[model samples]
Target chain A: MSGEQTAAIESDIEAAIREDHPALITYITAGDPSLEDTKEYVEALDCGGSDLIELGLPFSEPIAEGPTIQAAINRALDAGTTPARFFELVDELETDAPLLVMTYYNMILQYGSEPDVRPFVERAADAGLSGIIVPDLPAEEADPLRDACDEHGLDLVFIVAPTTAGERLDRIMSQVSGFAYVQARLGTTGARADVSNATHDSLTRLSAYDVPKAVGFGVSEGDHAAEIIEAGADGVIVGSALVDLIAEHGTGDAPAADALESKARELKRGARRGGEQRNGHEQGREEAPEPEQP
Target chain B: MSETESNPPAEDEPNRERTFGDYGGQYVPEALMPALQELEDAYQRYVLDNEDGFMDEFRERMRDFGGRPTPLQRADRLSKRYDREIYLKREDLVHGGAHKLNNALGQVLLAKYMGKERIIAETGAGQHGTATAMAATHLDMPCEIYMGRTDVNRQRPNVYRMRMNGAEVNPVDAGSGTLKEAINETMRDWATTVERTHYVIGSIVGPHPFPRLVRDFQSVISAEARDQIQEQAGRLPDSVVACAGGGSNTMGTFHEFVPDSSVDLYAVEAGGSSLEIDQDEGLAPNSATLSTGTDGVLHGAMTKLLQTTDGQIVESHSVSAGLDYAGVGPELSHLVDTGRVTPASVDDDAALNAFHRLSNLEGIIPALESSHALGFLEEAHEELGDLVVVNVSGRGDKDLETVLEETENRDLDAAPDVEVFDT
Candidate 1:
């Protein structure tokens, strides 16, 4: 809180996470069609140049989640996926992606939601994971995760929104390291063609800060990815879109790992292109000459 | 995700957009969404049934069993010292020894009519559990009560009483071993048993229809106070004071007073130890809902809670177990935030001292929870003269163990504890 991640994370927010110069983040649920596909998709995103990846593990009663996530969870649960199995698969994998595995608190608590976190975390780093975001577990209760991330040098990501307060931001920022996952809006995970201007303004507002922030929960295509970056976001995360891709490419075969690999490649390409645009814009702002002595 | 057009109709009461004015709305799991909507619809239709039948049935029980017209008596000694007319609504005098009987009877009756099979309840201090168990047993409905392990041990007598009354008791060990955990356990149980089980939430802290329904059931206190003040003192009291643990009595008395601009509603909370100590106590920690809570949520209902930065539930402390809740009842949250209700805290020492003072001066033994109300009187009664109504939610029997330990060997008349605080 006093030193480690705040100063470094803050500057990133204004230019990186904000829509003005953003990062394009893409998401795919773990064990969605199958565990193999989920891991493969994460690796594919990394290979394709996506800035960040949000890997979701399905749960039963996701009280805060919307219909899109609810369906993804059901599909995963139907495939015999559990938090324990998800963590196990992540432990076994060797990916070159920064994995942000998200899941519920109860499921986490039920099955080493704490003890099991350390392994995948270290493994994620080996495989190239940068951060993690679990929505249901609020920042205050994120005990072991905060400590684990510090010990392992992994990013324990925190989510903030327009609805978040200044006082709260300080506390949340205290617990998280790496970068903040700034939600595009309030409510559960979903994507919509018509994004709110207010949402965009909030992302832009955050970009004015210094924390390296990532925008998540929507942004379907190359254009949307480009828009988030232009608005100052360091990362633009696509989830339901990738889930849609997995649904399209998936077969009833074992794991469906290829589906995720293919989807991750496309999302990573789009998101990286967005990040490049952000870096370019920030450079432009930097290179802009001092105003001519009026 | 986008918030939809789900605000309830704007009425005079305009409940936090659900209508009880900042006091009511829908906040629950998606699984329970349809059920909540159905309950709201059923409640809407029942408002039409203002059928004298329900009201008449309520009065019948109040008179025959539940104890009707809880007396409005003056606390003679305190009144004289403060120069204010401090009248007490003796909900404590009711058959089950608390105000909870009023709501329990009302809810069980509603269940009987709704054709629910089994009844499930959550108890913090065990008062609500005991009362609900007694009522359901009286009405021949199967009852189950979930209590946190810590509470069950602290409030052993009530736990034993509930078990004896033929109610099954499940002890939960989650969260901070208090009401919040009890509530979470009850919610899970309700989801499993929702179809046949009528979750008679003890306080106005759950989803929509509950805040409104429990308040409606308990509102008789204020209705009577309005008439009692006119009949006895010839005017409405200037200020209404009640201890707010999950806020049943406070809501009961304040409901009639809230719409009355002239009458002030002040809810007293447990302020354990000193201001610093009180802030640190979990007896319902320094949850300044009325002052700080916006229209967000913590528990199952849309109420005020002292949440962590990432929205984790914070534990609260009060010498009074019932008030040892993390969240305030929804209406109380609304009342405090919207400027309709004024909330203040009295630390445990002040309440304990006042507890002794009441025993000495008025010869009336007050529950530790209710001592909070008197603590307010001892502190601020100088300004409020000739007009104050206090709700004595229960007898000191449930709190006798703690009382004896705190104020042991210190007495005025020493009426032998009355075996349960005799009138």
Candidate 2:
């Protein structure tokens, strides 16, 4: 808590990996129902054992998002969510887990003067944001913003897709400070009943690097989370499912928090299942080696 | 016209960077980077420099199916009226009734070579949609086109034509229901279905390779016009003029002649209401990105875009649905910066006037988009040399309803006043 923001995020992820626990990252579009609801949702996620919280700065067009997240963004925009409002909401968050802002490149590019993305990273640092993820800004086009983020003590996370080439993956991994986001599928963000082999393959490829690799997109259930963790993902990132839960059960409903709490716990249990099985082979005769910190 | 004519072309600037100044880069999501790279590699290997006869096959298809080498006809009647040499590059004679076929045919063929099973496209004015449909049918590929609800309603004939040619048209009602929103939807579709699908972008726009590739395919218009004009008119035209929307036709007609110092390139934008109107007043004049726009990214590429100070893309207004756009192609933006391509705008009123003039005087109906280029003739008459080739990008068959309505409105305005008295 006393160190720099990005260093704190890196250490936090490293600590989780050392503990042999998959970091549970929860994402919700800020100001979906309202900013107030979002604040409560953040607290709920933190209490529910989320290792990291991703606040979606709603854009007019969320192209990478599917129906659920897109509708959430639309609702947030209708509620008059702006980048200023997003930062303001983030300023109000009092949570144990690190907070990151996920947004499109244009929103950040538009925040300051033309062609200068530094102001955004400066503002994120000033606002106490641990990291920033631009899903649309690939590593190749992320140099300017990445430099600014590095200057402002903000971790710049890049996305690695199933379709990403080996060389491009290496390039992305080289630049990432926080965990690298590995898309769980070839399509837009949505929840599916079963994860595809492509997801496992992407995670396996991403595992070669030293970066913490978290898998998202179509990660809806505990089994889905477990499948990814079993395949060697360091973290599980869930978005649509939580948004869907929020939609089904209003923030006012006790069941909503309960559902989130249970879901988080179940996914955590699923995450531990892989390590537990590994430990079972030793049968208490020998202890497993502790994961190294970054 | 004054600035473009006086300013010289920057022959050295094209080699600067991957971007056109600060415009034209891959501004899309990371999910699309691999796809764009794959496309670039495929384009270089299979289409541009492959040992296989892919380029030949593409040319053969362009010749047999697309009817390439569309004529460059000298406009004798228009020349006499304007008292200037005016010629037309007949893209209208292309199989799909516009230059859109050039891009569609090449992309669909590329998609075929890449082993993609389906083709997806976004279209405005239905010209690109109809052309994509034609390519899809000819290649026996599944095709889906996203069209704005307003465009679908207005360009009903082209919509019908798209369906008749075997393509599904998804009507997008988002964001003023125009070309911009349609592109957003198509990008979403491509993101989800990139494995089996290829996005056949209709213009010299979008992210890299798209603008470059589409311009390369459509450049045949100017290439042919360059030679055809030399053979017929016995010299290069003084200026090359084409309507600019996403700027494929204009770039196609202008790209080959970029190094030609003497040849002036003029891009006529759809002036909609008027480029002179205050953009903040909620009355946006479409296709004036070059005139009243600042450089910003939209639809994927960094380009001159009609946007707010906060970078929110402003909706463009145009009577010509084909020319209704908030952003121009990135290369056009560079050309505009280097004073290579001169940006000219024609309001809806004048474009309609030109549409009527061409129909009546030359017995040829031009699309409202093409009418913008014809509309520029009034301004360029003084600057014209012995030869000026205007890219007649498309025929006006799809615009009959809009033309007929405007004509009726004009006729009603001209009707004699009648007074009625009751006893």
Q: Candidate 2 falls in which docking quality class?
A: medium
On the 0 to 100 scale, the lDDT of residue B293 in model 1 is 37
Q: Report iRMS values in order.
A: 11.9, 1.6
Q: How close to the true structure is residue A243 of candidate 2, measured as C-alpha lDDT?
A: 89
| Cα-based lDDT at residue B218, candidate 2 | 89
User: lDDT per model, in order?
Assistant: 0.67, 0.80
Model 1, span A173-289: residue lDDT tens: 565565667767544566678454645867766654555656665556666666665666666677877677667665555343455456555644565566666666666878754
Error of 1 at B99 (Å): 0.7
**For candidate 2, what is the lDDT?**
0.80
| Candidate 1: C-alpha RMSD after superposition | 16.2
Off by over 4 Å in 1: A1-294, B1-11, B14-24, B274-288, B291-295, B408-423
Which ten contiguous residues of candidate 2 chain A have the minimum total lDDT? A1-10
What's the DockQ for every one of the candidates? 0.03, 0.58
The DockQ score of candidate 1 comes to 0.03
